[model samples]
Target: MEPPVPSKPQFSLPVDSDHKATQFRLFSLSPPHMLAFHLAWLSLFSNFFSTFSIPPLLSLIRSDLHLSSSDIGRAGIASFAGSIFSRLAMGPACDLFGPRVASATLSLLTSPVVLSVSLIQSPLSFILVRFLIGFSLANFVANQFWMSSMFSSNVVGLANGFAAGWANVGSGVTQLVMPLIYSLLTNSFQIPTSTAWRAAFVVPAVFQAVTAILVLIYGQDLPDGNYSKKSKRSSSTGSGKNFFTVLFTGLKNYRGWILGLTYGYCFGVELTMDNIVAGYFYDRFGVNLESAGALAASFGLANVASRPGGGVVSDKMGRRFGMRGRLWGLWVVQTVAGLLCVLLGRVETLWGSVVVMCCFSVFVQAASGLTFGVVPFVSKRSLGVISGMTGSGGTVGAVVTQLLLFSGSNQFSTQTSISLMGLMMIVCTLTLGLIYFPKWGGMFCGPSVEPISEEEEEDYFLLE
Candidate 1:
């Protein structure tokens, strides 16, 4: 018998058209693609917005609830610990059960916890609720695996970029809008400030619940490729042994660890900055809550705008150079931005600090887009595992960064402490670029780039 031939992949849009014509075609075809894009974007939005909401409200929660810095740190730890645990579960579950079920279920589950945040009175209770929210919010990873697997390799960057960019908008939106929303609702309804924050949570929670329900209704499931139903059954039944086997196999691949470490550094710096920036501003310049929240949103705005642009540029640049170049470029940009944090004192005026912070946010977000953009190209079959491991690294980094921020407790001189932390970020960037980049580049280097499977090819076309 002859060997079976693999079918050629089809793109919804032609890959080889003239630049102008391609743009025109993409614009024309965008309506349908936009539907999927927006659906995915909403998932991203829900995940990020929910993730960022608590930071802006931290001071209020601390003072009103009489919580300590360590207490707040524990809350952060609880949230990320939940995220870590959920990611571990979702990675394998996503591969086994499919993205649609995993994503919609998790997103739906998270809504109640988000709504409950405003009602928590004690630090322990708050931490516990946040942990639940984190666990249920594993939809972020599920969504990433789905979108990446659904899009074509040629434009996977763009799809991921769009989702990442828009999703980040949630954080910016939360930062920019939450304080205002809280203020307005508090004054308008004569609600207590705590009640206002709870009310603030309602908007995103409702939005997420509705979005998740819609996704469940309309979201297409990606087909299982090489893994068969029989194999899945056997693996599940033997998962105790399979778990160790997969773990050992994955660990043997140095590339995964290198990528995980690189991701960890970026994740750590980004999370640390995201969690601490409002407090950093408040401590450094005595900025009010609203102003600090707005400034923190700047990172999201910059991230959202730059991510799609990064994808387009990466597409033009080719995977190896594009991915590698962005990695190195982000390293430089992050280093400069970290150094720029030292200038927080030199800024003197609140507006000056805001401007610098916004610029800093832009670089951080661009780095985020670039880091995630490399995931699809690393390994097609193991995308879930790669994402899980690297994502976990990033989460761990975040936990570490938060711990560092919490430790720097000279309440009167937080600016100096933040500046020192910024210096550490500079070190992290340098280490990532010089030590890790070359190692990762070598491990992922190869010519046998596994083609996107037929079902995903179909999904990408439907998306377009």
Candidate 2:
């Protein structure tokens, strides 16, 4: 007797005309849409927290481990280097295993590395631990992919922006939280500085592990349901191509490469700043540890509104001018952000530097959000791969900037190198002109009369 034919996957959850969520209710926990949004961002937040938790205590760690300036820079580069390949791999993993599994597995695997910060007795060990801990950042690809899967084009920018922006708050939160934890241990509890810094890492480790478990148990992979519940046939068709197919599809698309390069400056710059901002304030302005952490927090805290604003503006532009509007908006915002970064490097006074950094933070983060606002439209069939490529670009950009500009051997002063980095960002933003969608048109051109393919139709219906 022949076996029973597998029933087709059914999507019973409420969604828009495109089988995506129309509204983004902030407080709702409804499965597969809002619920997925919260899980994605929270998981990313934990990862970000774990990734940057050491920066706030870098000074103490440096003293404790007897690290040199070059060693510090190498550690920073190592952290970003760890993320680059993992992010590239995570895209394909999400395509094959689903974001729920991909995200949770990454967090769980990396949490132990985060906890290992206390074990570093040498520069090599410190760098190695940071490298391993950086793997948690691959969850960022999963976060963006999940949002793209769950939300519709009309609000995809907003959903992506909010999820990323909120998750980014972890960087800022770690800035403040790590310092406070260290202070409490050293001051209130009378612990030694060396012991306090090591102990501070335990909090982020626990946070990362708990969030990973939560995601694995409760998170949904698609609007329909978790990927595991679907039959073999439905899983492949529903989630798009398999790993290598999706990877190659995203690789072959010129648009994904251009966006990757563009994101490197925006989000990449943000990562660099997260690594150095506290130390910059501490050394340059003679601020105390807590004060420097507070100031550094300001730059990261801007993500709460600045990134979402970029997405909101992108959505508004897409409504008015399709992909062209989104591209134009990205160019303009990133250009302005570059200008602000140049200005930040020039500011001489402490308060002046703070003000300029705040403005620079806004434009840089918004540029990141805007960059992603255009990502979901690049190739729907390979969204995870495209997202991974873009996410990895951010880390690559950070590594390059850190190596050339901020690394210990560079002759350029920290401020001067920052100005040069800004100059590079301005030049990079020009590449936005190279991105063009067949149906929605290019930045300077109008849409062609050619018919929209099924993938284009689903991802760009808002242009109609």
Cα lDDT of model 1 overall? 0.64
248-296 in candidate 1: lDDT tens per residue?
Answer: 4444545556556655555556666667778777766788999888878
The local lDDT score (0 to 100) that residue 459 gets in candidate 2 is 51
Task: Write down the TM-score for model 2.
Answer: 0.94
Clash-forming residue pairs, model 1: none
Residue range 92-205, candidate 2, lDDT tens digits? 888777899999998999999999998889999999998999889999999999998899888899999989998998999999999999989989999998899999999999
Which stretches of candidate 2 lie above 4 Å from their native place? 1-14, 235-240, 451-464
Error of 2 at 73 (Å): 0.6
Error of 1 at 263 (Å): 2.2
